[model samples]
Target: MIASRTHGGGRITVDQRADGSGEALQAIIGDVGDLSVQAAVGDFDLATLLTQVPAPLTALNLDACRMRFHRQLAASLLELETTAVGVKAAAFAYRQAEKGISEAFGGLLDAIGYATGRIIAISLPVIIPVAITIGVQVLVVSKILDVTGLDDVITTHFGIDLGKTKEQAKEALVTAVFEHSDVAGAVIEHVLPGIVVGFVGLPPALLDTDADHAYWPHDSQSMTVWLLAGANQFGLLLPSDVEVWEAEGVTPPHEKPPRDLEDLYLREAACHRGTDSGQVRIEEIVGPDGTTRYIVYVPATTDWSAKSGDNTTDMTTNVQGMAGNDTVMREMVRQAIADAGIDPNDEVMLVGYSQGGITAGSLAADPAFLADVNVTALMTVGSPISDFAIGSDIDVLSIEHEQDLVPDLDGNENPAADNWSTITVDYDPDELRKAPALRDKSDAEIADLFDSAGAAHSSTAYAASIALLLRSGNGSLDRFTAKNSGFFTGDLKKTRDYQGRRKHT
Candidate 1:
């Protein structure tokens, strides 16, 4: 059996119970009850039949048979309904047990996180002094070696040189300390939560200070919330006017709708290749029912530069997106959707990976966007979007890998709602090795590559995991597939590409 937990629709099911089963079972029970009620009141029109027969004894016998049949049918229907209730009750108990265990695990993690943050806060005074002492020791050691000419001697004789100059020596010492210290690694690992804890501990008065009262770029919001919030509040993280235009020389449209999740992911992956290939893919699908629907594919961050430039899908946008702030990436996509001529009444599905996923969630959560488009479904892979309060009417499927730390950046678990489901699979490095970028490498090289964090976040690995889920006969995934069948069965009406760049101020 697949190891998975589904929470939503007011029920929790571990690996044993399939998602949507309780709702389906309850519907059946309701139908059974309705049939039992109908059977109890139903008649065979026997009085009319007797009038035509013109034999009192025969007619009375026929009426008696009808009454018996009606009694038996009603009794049988009631028995069936009772059995369904029992089955439903048993399933509910099992599901509740699973939900309890899952919550326990989540609670444990929450406790640990809070404990760690509190400990760090309480120990900062001691930690700072200890760090200062270590730094002094490193400075003294460097000075001694430099003053005695031992640094040059070691460099010449043993090919061991820490640094030539005093400044370089200090820098080298600090670098060595960080490289060899697990403490440094731990600090980096917990930075996201640490910042949140720090923010949470601030006084209400401090947090309430108006950001507008401060100087531009040094507002109270930035100062109180730290760098990410500050950058956005100060306008440094704001996107330039996104100039979106129709992409030219883009690849031809597919003949049919995406066949599976992997195919959709691959399409999302394509958006990251380069801006010339187009940053967004909008497909107008003519569904089998003659209604038109749209699928918008958004890509991960293409640029990691500190400064926001032409491409709104950059590191700046990543920060803005994760902070749940308005971003140029989102604006570009929104504009593209409008340019595609998708009406407010048209059904739309959004697919995104990484930053794209965050953008998609933001769009789905935005009231303004909802007013402009009928977003029916959203799928996000390797995105930290738990904080987005998307509407329950939208069917949401968030796919994540346990080892991919990106989704954890939000510092919150995805909401457990009936309409929203998160599928988290354990990482397999073998899947990473099959990535196109790694396929041509040697075995040794591939082994080394597995150590990279990016390996776990690979779109290819995500796609491979999705393939396993599709084949795993998991009930939750099947239900999702059935509900969104419109997106997968349609013919590709047309494909449009749009690119945006931040306007230079």
Candidate 2:
């Protein structure tokens, strides 16, 4: 069973619930939903080919082979829904079925049985609560290994190593226990509320389903978040004999206006300019009417949390960064924006990757920040901002790698407001290997995933992704272009800001 939906120009809910009561990965659910449509197309192609066959055929099981191929090809197609349209088409059909299902189901049981045919017509997707997905995984894990043993398995196999001392490894093992436990709790958080109301003879509707605090972790994010969280902790605790001085502040402005949002030259220009110097680069373009448009680019977190992980306060400072830790990053951006002497009246667009995406999102949502700067747009790649309640005025585009788990770390998505749009890209390493420059790096990156955890989180990967979207003529890309066309219209002046880490004794 597969289920997916989009509300009023609204974002797709990406409900993972399939046939029964299990919530599979969102991509799996999407692929399964399109099976029928794809089968029809395949059938058409086969029929067209069969017409060319000679009528006087020798004894052959070629027909059987064709049937087998049909089935096998379908399975392979389902493995990857090559285009966004194919994955999303069934969801659109499902929406239509839902509107019609209510009318058909209103009559008799016999009539309902007749409507069952229409149910098939409705599609193969089912809606299951989140509980089932978690329960199944938990049961499977229990059969294979106890929780404690699993901790050792994950710690030794999954956790990052910057050559930490023995004590640090021991500490990480202890921390892994909770990180692992969050897995089961993540399941409970989803199904428990709806279950409780039903058990108490209350309407399921009584459950507060739309709250900001739902635990909706995607299948891909579970371990990735753990790895990142662990990496931040390790980077902070693993003492280096030599004190490394890392600077954190934006550099003086470098004055070239960006020509196109999709241009790699511009993106590379923004990315290469800020290496190790800071978290964000401020670029300015002077519009015809004398209005300045500031494009503030924030790369993903350089470090997870604070370098010194002495206490729980460390969570607040982790460089992988957190929603609550927005202020720490925001202050740096805020100060940089100020130093750029950006006119309060100038339009601002924030762009970021991963943690920087979250930072970009957090600042855009803040009323105080918006009141001060005319923030007109936000573009984030592989960043999750479901917790943010941003307004409808800003034109927001969230680009996510379909296989990248970093964006789904929050377990929820940005509100489905009309102003907000999301585009999911697939940078599966297998596909990345086709590129010569990426070949060696892709091979060295372990498929064990634990070792190559940064697979889709790189700025380079996001750049490649944006390039794909542009070439594919993605609707979101068109919209993004039309919205920002005005900024590059007049004589352009580019400004750059620098930020970096400061070493402590």
Question: What digit string (tens of lDDT, one per residue) describes model 1 on residues 337-438?
Answer: 989999998989999999899899999999998999899999999887876789999999888877666776654568878888888776666665554455
* Candidate closest to the true structure, highest TM-score: 1
- Candidate 1, pairs of clashing residues: 8-417, 8-418, 9-417, 9-418, 222-230, 310-501
lDDT of 2 at 170: 70
Model 1: lDDT to the true structure: 0.70
TM-score of each: 0.65, 0.51
Superposed Cα deviation of residue 106, candidate 1 (Å):
9.4
lDDT of each: 0.70, 0.54
Pick the lDDT winner. 1
Cα lDDT tens digits for candidate 2, 255-334: 34556655512353354333433345676777777766878876554433544432211223323344233444566677
Off by over 4 Å in 1: 1-6, 9-133, 136-225, 232-236, 249-252, 274-278, 431-449
Q: Pick out the ten consecutive residues of candidate 1 with the lowest summed lDDT.
A: 215-224
* Poorly placed runs, candidate 2 (over 4 Å): 1-255, 264-277, 305-321, 433-451, 500-505
Error of 2 at 431 (Å): 3.5
